[model samples]
Target chain A: MAEERTPLYRRLSRRHLFRLPLLHSRNGKRRWPIRSAGINFALGYGVLFLISATLFLSFIWWSSTNLLNDHVRAFIETDAQELRHRWGHGGAPALSEAINDRLEQNIDDDALYLLIDRHGRRMAGNLPGWPVAVKKMNHFYELTIRRYTFTTPAQFKAYTLPHGFKLIVGHDIRGRTLLSTVITRTLIWCAVMISLLAVGGALVVRDLFRRMVGSIARTASAVANGDLNHRIALTGSETDLVAETVNTMLDRINRLMEGVRQVSNAIAHDLRTPITRARNQLEEAFFSATSPDELRTAVDRAIGDLDHITGIFEALLRIAQIEAGARRSAFTTVNLNQLLSNMAELYEASAEDAGLSLALDVTPLPSLFGDERMLQQALANLLDNAIKFSPPNSMLTLSAHPVMAGTAPGSGAEKKPQGLEISVRDQGPGMNDADILRAHERFFRAESARNTPGSGLGLSLVQAVTSLHHGRLTLTQANPGLKVTLFLPLLPEAERTGRSTTPAETTP
Target chain B: MRILLVEDDPTVRSFVLKGLKEAGHNVDQADNGKDGLYLAIGEKYDIIILDRMLPGGIDGLNILETLRGQKNNTPVLLLSALSDVDDRVDGLRAGGDDYVTKPFAFSELLARVEALGRRGHNESAPETSLTVGDLTLDLLSREVRRDGQKIDLQPREFRLLEFLVRHAGQVVTRTMLLEKVWDYHFDPQTNVIDVHVSRLRQKVDKPFETAIIHTVRNAGYILRPTQD
Candidate 1:
């Protein structure tokens, strides 16, 4: 309906420019195809070419006529002088005889001569009074005359001569004029006909190209508006590279969307269990508790269950925040040593309470650029997992050292540039190949560690935070347990040494 | 003794009602804030139990706020499912004399009610001590005597005994214990309340020849003169 309401030009402009059509689109839009640009250019050129051709041909015709007339005038003047010379030497008889002899030799036509002794009469030529006898200096004039010849009938001109003699000459130019007219008319007709044909051909191509591109555009619009299932119909013969590129991009986007859907589902499914459990526990206590002691016990159990639920929720929220890619703008120069040391202190008691030996081997480190809270959370989760999964009393070692200055592969780009490498090693059951690969999958629990109580969101959170920091997290087995190492680029020494305590901004 | 309960959940209301009934107190239930407020204003309840979340334009917090606004000194025990410390702080700040979380055991509910009831009575009766039967208490001196012998008590135990005695024959709810004696502030959702109550009971009741504090099965406790 909207398409019908909007003129065609509007739709075209909008599709081309990715915006609403401007005011000029109110007219019933012209269905200009993509080939319209070329078609318009060709049509305009052809029309101008035809107009110029007509003018050129007409000029040529006029110029040819003028040139022939000039030649005739020159010949008459010379011939008349010769006639006077003849008349002066031998009187009128000689001139008449000469004129008659010249006429008899002109069997080809377009030739004429006359001799009149100062009288309005022709003497020695086909019957024709002097044509265009307007006054001239020396009694000379030029004019077209209709006359009859001994053999042919045609138009001729009489050039009156001096001393009682006139010379009339004629030669047939009508046949030549007819042939030139045919040639000029044929050339003009060919030019105009070709131009009209070119315009017709261009319109056809414009309409064809419009349909082809419009179909693809419609499909793309549908996809942009969230109909991921829509695919461009590879219509027309021109669909080669464009169709291939669009299809590939759509395939990748669909895959990414699927992954997001799966993660969302996992969060919903796993978090509900603990929340329901806590609710049920509370309900039971409210109904059956007999004394203050029983009531307090019930409330305690419910609170504990709620704590677990909150834990999962908090972790999920943190991961989501990291994934939103906003933390990049909040990056600041952070002291890795101080950040790690703070975490080490915070988790030491927790680790001690869990009967795990936790150690922080901090090598004096340069500053790094990142969100402090996110880094702390990521590191804390890693350490928490190590402490939780490892057997009680196992030694867990944490170390941070600079990536050797020039150890990067072939590129000297980041050579010897100070970046910190942090690793956490545990002495409990180590992860095998399968576990290591899928550890970052949300809600994925290791087969050997299923009995333990956890939501399996830790590694995923760690991965998200690491990505936010523009860092890499590698998981490997430490011979006896799991080892997770993180590499984060370091800020220059000046920024790191400037200030120690600043909260990271969340705006980005 | 009489008690007033204000809670929105039907399940929780019925369970708490049954427990208090078994504890031998006349129990009144109000589903939401308006009805609860009407009840609190019209009736003289030994203790008023309030739920933080309620329907009908009045929540536990609102009821407490209104009650305090009206200068009604009836002790209110606020109940909720939220156990966060911030929530507790807000509830208490809103004039809730005591606060408790949901999924509470009946016993803890009764203990809190009794404590609030006793605290309310003590405010009324500012005299240092009050005695019934052979048990005598000196509030000013913080002393207790049973059969003419001085009996020492922990602060929590003294507070518990004081609540039981104040409402000597009434049933208290577990929500009561959470709010009053422990001043739990937030629901720990742990058995810490029960553990503390048991220790108090062992000290206050177990050593006595005539137990003044009697557990009422699913209901709370009753402090009465020796039956003999």
Candidate 2:
């Protein structure tokens, strides 16, 4: 029912008045001017110059036309008066002979004269309306004569007379009008020339801008392709804000790459020693092992050492993967209560074996978004450290609960509702403030706990995994022990709706 | 019994060759896996000691794999420096009878080779309870008794005495102690081997009138029967 919309190209061309005929003609003709930004600028300059020149020339033309008319009228009037005087005394023969002789001597041929008496009779004049239009005096009229335009004015003052015999004088202005036309054509031609020159100027500027953009694009492509070594050559002035920002970005990238290289080198160096030790131990056992019991014992102990080296490598790799932000894609809704209960069950036996008691108190917690494996690994590491450091028969308590509205961290200062907090507490050798602060550093053994067996990577791995999940891990002293608390965002559904879910419980 | 020992290091090769000869086994030495494999195939030996990683083209695993592929079950005991879980699994899976990481004890090696020999011939099972000089070990009970007096032994001490008694006259290096007693395949930075051996010596050597465990200078321990 609705009319179909016109094609965009057709509509645009129609609106621009670029009809088919005009387009065909334009295409066929070889135009010296190209219409681009450069051409537009030149055309604008030329048009402005032309307008100014036209106004000035038009003014000159109008004044000159008036002056030339006035001078020619006065000469015509003087000749007419002199002829009239001679004709009135002598006869027609004398007047005719004098006018014809004057006509032969005139150079501009634009001048015309007419003379008439009170009887309205035509005397010596090239025009027929000698004194009829001049009777009212000083009347100007534009007349079309012989396919040309002429201005005619009759002046009563230009006529002089004795009593009943009056002499009328008139002038033609066609020659002055023709001269004004010539001036107009010259000004228009000059305007077109200047406009073309402006187009050329705009083209030069356009080319310069294109070149600058091209170089920038090329450098950007190189950087995008992972050649961090490539840097953009600074073109233009330092004042260019785009150049400044790009250079700053490149500098940051270079620094980051250097840091990555250093870290990998350090890791490789540290890892090689343990791996080499594991290898040499195996060789000794193979040659001298005399009994099956001796050989089996040797192989088992080597595997243990090998497992340690593999653990270190895996921990390093996990940290790097977490830092890369690629694992965020694996995020899913996680039930914190279930996770805590499972962890408590797994670690409680190990803790008791180490002479440490593990306690778990789980309250209602909204599910969180996270990778389950990574979260479990992180929590396991934390618990491993807690149980390892705790003295014989020390209690390690793990609890998860909603950070109740009023009792939440920052209390009323926080914008959102309370988050969910899970904490692992141990009644063991608590670290000082400085050790707690440096606890998350890699391979950093606490001065007080240096005697303990650990690789010192547990807490660092926890920190990396915690930050990656957009959660916060904080360490605080439990007066006589160390407590680690993690705060994670509550699930979207249970958080904003304020619905309470059933709490899950765990036993020590 | 004739044994073929393939090792690259000169010191290790000579030490092993001497230890094998002293243990009353004929020893043939090869520097690399290629020559070792050639000699192993060309001439028959009771057992072959092949290093897992060798300097030449044929690695220990490759040589072992090639021998087994040709239906040669010559009982290879693989020796390697790569003492990782995966490396051990790979060596065993690649047709090796037994695998030992580097720096191994000569006594353990001699015992394993003897076991391998016993395995090839369907001979009578070796004694479950073994006796050397004044010491007696009950394999079933995991107990050690000297002259009708009961001796308490830790797991490691028990295992050490068992190995020493099994290869009574062989020389075992500290490197061998790390590999066999501690189950470590590489050199230990700590003097863990010496510490454990001293503890064993306190239990097994200190109380006995005739000591069986002897420390050989710059070599290893030798558990030989008393000459009286």
Question: Model 1: per-residue lDDT, tens digit, B61-114?
Answer: 888888889888787788888654457668889877777665565666776666
**Residues A1-508 of candidate 2: C-alpha lDDT, one tens digit per residue:** 0011123223333443434233334458744333344434544554566567767887888898778767765665576668777778766656656766766776756545555555867666565554333444443433444313534333233444554444444445566667867987776566556544644555675576657666667777888998877766776653246765776677666755754674587477766766777777788888988998988887877776776776676566566556555566567788777778866755665676666778878775667777676777777777877876778977999887777466654334344445777788888888888888888766667887777666667777777777666667888999889999877655466442332221112110
Candidate 1 local distance difference test against the native: 0.68
In model 2 chain A, where is the ten-residue run with the lowest total lDDT? A499-508
Top TM-score model: 1
| Candidate 2 error regions (>4 Å) | A1-259, A286-288, A291-293, A352-355, A367-369, A401-415, A447-453, A489-508, B1-228
In model 1, which runs have C-alpha deviations exceeding 4 angstroms? A1-180, A187-241, A289-377, A390-422, A447-454, A464-472, A487-508, B1-228
lDDT of 1 at B25: 78
Q: Candidate 1 residues A1-508, lDDT tens each?
A: 1222234334343443454423234576654443346465555555556566667776877787768766765666676667668877887788888777777886765565656667666667654665555344344344434555323333334454555455555444554456576867677566747555655655575677677677678778988999987777665477646775677667656755765776679767997888888888788888988898998988888777876776676566556555655445556677788778755654565566667878877767767777765676677778778877878888999888777566842224445655668889999898898888889888888998798878888878778777665567889888899999887756565754443222222111
Q: What is the lDDT of residue A67 in candidate 2?
A: 88
In angstroms, the error of model 1 at A7 is: 23
